[model samples]
Target: MNAAATTHHHTSCLRCGRKLTSTKSVATGYGPTCTRKVKAAAKAEVVAQYKPHQVAKAEELIEQGGLIPLRGQIYLAVSSDGSQTYKTHRAACSCPAGIKGLHPCKHRIAAHILSLAA
Candidate 1:
């Protein structure tokens, strides 16, 4: 057992912050799984963006089957009142609650859930 060979640098992946398992991962600054996610997210497409709390709400909505994914960035949200609200990222909503800006609405939350699922 050579003492000089015992040391290792616990480098973390830049994307997922997981411990880099390979010398290549440490050099590249990303793990394999996170590298794929980062590349997919970097594509010229609408990625469902969400804050931490919004993701939490989206998780619940997804479990309840209240979120439906439409084409592209569009999604349909089934509200508690049984009315359907269309949520397009940064677009209008049919529901009275409305969806706009950075505010988190049920429809918007559902759309986010759909985005993550797709």
Candidate 2:
């Protein structure tokens, strides 16, 4: 017997008990008549509404060598280690400013400035 014929069959949606035309297993196949469509639509809506400003800020940081200087001799370094998903990791100079609870140090700021000039 074929695999499809061997599988157990359920003809109603698990969520709403409506007649099921298709399962959500396949990529492009029709899904459960109501809940599947609603869930998928909601997911798309959330993704579409993402903020562009935050994305642009990150790109600017990349262009600037992932380094920023705030005040005095403080420097900050931002790093990431993920393909599709980004995980921000920061490193700072070991200057007194950093050790005293201030963000970044002078070394990172200098590096960033040099990188920008070049």
Candidate 3:
């Protein structure tokens, strides 16, 4: 192939507008430093939306493999009792607390955490 045909044109970074040359950076649209900052900011936003206890529980659920990805943003969260599974999404969950709409449930929080990690 000719040099011009083989040459990869660098894309602008999504966060900083710097030219991205690395394959991973080009694919993700962010350079290494900007990628870290973007991910940290996203995680912080997710954490800020939930209570400390809820975030703790979500982390525990993730560590224990209690949250299983079903498809897309949907997940199957095993109940603490291990007797039931609830369909969960970042914004919605099938758990009782979620159904009642009192507040964001632990299952929902877990989904958000998992999404951010991905």
Candidate 4:
């Protein structure tokens, strides 16, 4: 037998960071499987941190149809036709919260908060 005829391959586990030397891959990531696991973990981390507020709001919106949440920390309700439903955006002293340029109008906030409650 010639030692030089055979070459050694090195592989590592993604989760545990352990060295492996198996030609066949395992679900735990001995070689090729390892890369996929690593990528999946990274993708999950990104998705977890992305649009945290939006995620929360999505749940709330389902609850209160009339009550809408806004970026200015105000709540409003509009008709199905998209007309102003309520008065006074809470974040500002003004009676109209809908006009506020905040990221979400009161209607949006109310919808988000209500959905979460539901």
- Top candidate on TM-score is 3
List model 2 lDDT by residue over 14-87, tens digit each. 22345656444221112334334433443344225334443344333433334333333333444332111111
Model 3 has an lDDT value of 0.69
Q: What is the overall TM-score of model 3 with all chains considered together?
A: 0.62
* Global lDDT of each candidate: 0.49, 0.35, 0.69, 0.38
- The alpha-carbon deviation from the true structure for residue 13 of candidate 2, after best TM-score superposition, in angstroms, is 1.0
In angstroms, give how far residue 22 of model 3 lies from its true place: 30
Report the poorest 10 consecutive residues by lDDT, candidate 1.
1-10
Clashing pairs in 3: none
Better of 1 and 4 by lDDT: 1
**Segments of candidate 3 deviating more than 4 angstroms:** 1-43
Ranking by TM-score: 3, 1, 4, 2
lDDT of 3 by residue, 45-106 (tens): 77678778887777666544566566887987778776677899989989899899889888
Number of the top candidate by lDDT? 3
Q: What TM-score would every model get versus the actual structure?
A: 0.41, 0.20, 0.62, 0.22
Over 4 Å off, model 4: 1-50, 67-84, 87-97, 109-118
RMSD of each: 16.3, 20.1, 12.7, 21.9
